[model samples]
Target: MKKHFLPLILSFLLFACGNPKETNNEKLTIVTTTSMIADVAKNIGKDSVSVTALMGPGVDPHLYKATQGDLSRLQGADIILYNGLHLEGKMGEVFEKLARIKTVVPVSKGVDPTFLLSDPVFTGSIDPHIWFDVSIWSATIKEVLAIMIETDPDNEAFYEKNAIAYAQELTDLHEWVTNEIASIPYNQRILITAHDAFSYFGRAYGIEVRGLQGISTLSEFGLKDRVDLVNFIVEKQIKAVFVETSVSEKNIKAIIEGCQQKGHNVVIGGRLYSDAMGAEGTAEGTYIGMVKANVNIIVNALK
Candidate 1:
């Protein structure tokens, strides 16, 4: 009995000592609601934290239903970040609950209220998809920096430095988008897509945007939408319409066909990464790359 007890005590001591240094080095575990927010967090957090995106490429945040794994990640996170304003639809409740337990931040909260879009569908509520405009996103990034600093005050200097660098990049990107979009003729710069996800983009770049559906993917396109867009395309003599990566192109295809039936020649501008970034490892996979790819596609197609 004494020999057996001695072995048990030694085993307990080994277990207590095992990997103590490795456990202490574990980085802050951060969970984000969407890939876009996850991308921005990574840029600012750099190597200071471990970030995970609940949604992947082409996943629609509006219709996303959180899985058990997502809840577990959120529950374990040191900080949870999401684009608020009901972008996650029903899943926003989950984040609300998590906020009670941990540091949950709506990165878009700091965006100027005036810059937000108000639509009848939402009873004049602001649009949740504010990341489409780089300038607006710059404000969101600041909110993110504040959350990061709050979570790890010891790393305040690092987060501040990274946020400044990232903000500069965003400023450059905004200027580049403005210059590139300016190259397109105003009359020829109409942006038609499967949905009205680009309202902020159009507003920012001075382009007219029409959509087959409303802001939310849950909404369906009606005959009125089709007729109005077809007429607009014919009236404007627009050359092409765009489809989104996450949304079905069926509606846009119908629009293209309707325009052709009316003898109005139009083609698909190319697929735009609206709700998601490009496939991993591609140039358009990152947030900055995604915005640049979109600008390049729009400028090339419209110009």
Candidate 2:
């Protein structure tokens, strides 16, 4: 009887120590759909929350499928965040279902619906790439702060203070980006990439932007796209075309070959972080870092 009692006590202790339920004071466990959202949530949450981004650097969110581990993480998290506006494509359905059970918030849901681009494929649908503009992202950050406060009322003040500080940083970033881009002559500031992810960026920064692929990666690049872009580059004497970190460079390479065939010289400006950020520990790993890297690349390439 004594031996049996001792074993029961050991089991209880192990369960208590190893499987302790997360407390309010303990870090809030947050699962996000993309690295960019994870970065912004980190800034607002600071040390108060532990963030796990399902999509890492160079991952296309539209094509990303949730793994079993990701589902498990989402199931257990105190809060789940996604870009929404269908950025996750098929994954958006999963988040919608999870919303019924837990606090699943779309960080970009607060953006003015008018700011979203209308796409032909989805007819009446808006583009999900709102983070391309810093002003639009300021609104998204506010929503993140509100969600954090709602999840952990005890940390409301802390989250608010951090958010204000971070928002100021974003404000400064926007001004800096505006000034930097203004230095480049308008004609030299065209941005051509693998997809139409930068319409917001171009709209805000005063640049002409084009992409080989449509807003969704589900669409394939066709001959018309190739011919149009190649001819545009040749006719305009466009200096550089950029490639996205997550997308294949094959299409951009073909564009280069086409330009060369026309006796026009074009250079690959640099890789840009579109749907995702750089790897952890790199300058472009965080949201701010990703924007800064893009601004630097665009300024240097165009100037």
Candidate 3:
């Protein structure tokens, strides 16, 4: 079916399933585009909301296309939250269609423009990976809180309390990441990865970052880009290049081999959670835990 038919199909499904508002006897249902957003919503909404993430562990949101099941979940939800800033690049049309009938909010909307990073390759576009910086991600928590409170006014106090507690944890996480990344020798504080997902992390933690691909993993790097990156790695004697959990390891592997060809041996550093988090029930599963995991990996490899 044509992509524009999503809303029409969703409408038919909703009609067949009965009105969600009149049914849905459980807590408020929230459907988020990424696991990171789901984690934040769950923390803020707590027991007051039932949350589900369309993308799972190691799923790249940039190229993700919503399946028919996802449409149903989204259509049935009381709130639909996404990273926005074109993070869910392929699902924009679906979101636009759903917005007409229900509450579909971009959690990034509340973030100050001054705090956003520009996409170098795409002029007039902002990088969508704001969650890499714990401080910036904390802003999204407030956005989720505001929407939840607005949608369920009776639980305003409850949502506010949860947001306050989550905010403090994020504050502590930001400090911890800063100190840990600082431990890496200043010159050795470079993070090379498959794609440019960690620019916010590097900015927040004082590390220099390079990626083979552009901000989006879907953006390809040509032979010249690879050669240049290899030359830089060899010249700087960079210890390692990391792979992303969500992106292919092929690009990083190519970088490592290119360095070796020039007699500069570089190993694959531990994989980092870029666009996605770890599986559910794991330490890296939650937003804070994922940040800590990445910090520990970078510090251990680069320090």
Candidate 4:
């Protein structure tokens, strides 16, 4: 079905939708790939732009495909913001077609390539989970700020003020995460999750990290991978391993069972928000809130 949707996007591209920016009274319609990007856009574009996210809570962007309605929304949007670096792995063609006709911004564009972590399994590709590190994620806010201001210069001052405040909030969050993770003794700061999404988090906060699957959930893990992970858990005597909200728990459960067979009682720490944020209107729905929730979960479980 998704293979068929790309051709439909080409057709949608042929028709010109009404440009909301041309009118003075209407607000700009912003469509985002993930809720994390939508939350930031909403905070900065507040009351000035109408923002909508195509992928909601628990939706894995790695495997997510655009729908007919999503194509319609993408066609109608004034600007489209997405986390590039192949995070939205299945929607590359959709973004390419949309880019020719509208303002499509990849928030990760502002991140310094030198600072990016390369994928160990997939050569030449970098990790897309920049949001795990609050400081690094601020780079994305800058990208959004620049794009919003470029598209709507009239609100340049407003956007600048909002971006500054948002940046400071993230700075504080980064500090808090550093201090919180420190509480869990250095030797015990091992964060094992369902996938390699938290490599940035571990690097930024001084914790060792491991994942059953590779960087992207789309990658598969075989029996040997599971056996090695179970052996590592038993050897390290690690307390708990976490499952991601956007990923399947079957893998983690199997790891726990494997640990049990070796007399190591490993528990599921908590469901951490990895590829996606929590449901809308909840604390974890927002990026900052999601970070705080994850930090708290990790600290409580490990400490």
* Per-residue alpha-carbon lDDT of candidate 3 for residues 1-303, written as tens digits (9 for 90 to 100): 222222332232211111123233469899999999999899977777899999999899999999999999999999999999999999999999999999999999967688799999989999999988777777787678778878886666667666767776777787788889989999999999999998888887899999999999889789999999999999999998899899988878988888999999999889999999999999999998998898888888887
Q: What is the lDDT of residue 180 in candidate 4?
A: 95
- Per-candidate local distance difference test: 0.81, 0.82, 0.85, 0.86
Instruction: State, as a TM-score between 0 and 1, how close model 3 is to the true structure.
Output: 0.91
Clashes by residue pair, model 3: none
Go through the candidates in order and give the C-alpha RMSD of each one to the true structure: 13.6, 13.0, 9.5, 9.3
Alpha-carbon lDDT of model 2: 0.82
lDDT ranking, high to low: 4, 3, 2, 1
> Model 3 Cα displacement at 148 (Å)?
0.5
Clashes of each: 0, 0, 0, 0
| TM-scores of the models, in the order given | 0.90, 0.90, 0.91, 0.92
Q: Which rank order by TM-score, best down to worst? A: 4, 3, 2, 1
**Backbone clashes in model 2:** 0
Structural RMSD, model 2: 13.0
User: What would the per-residue lDDT of candidate 4 be over residues 1-303, giving only the tens digit for each residue?
Assistant: 312322332232223222224338778789999999998898877778899999999999999999999999999998999999999999999999999999999999977686689999999999999888877777777778778878887777676666666666776788898899999988899999999999999888899999999999989889999999999999999999999999999999999999999999999999999999999999999999999999999999998
How close to the true structure is residue 103 of candidate 2, measured as C-alpha lDDT?
98
Where model 2 places Cα greater than 4 Å from the true spot, the runs are 1-24
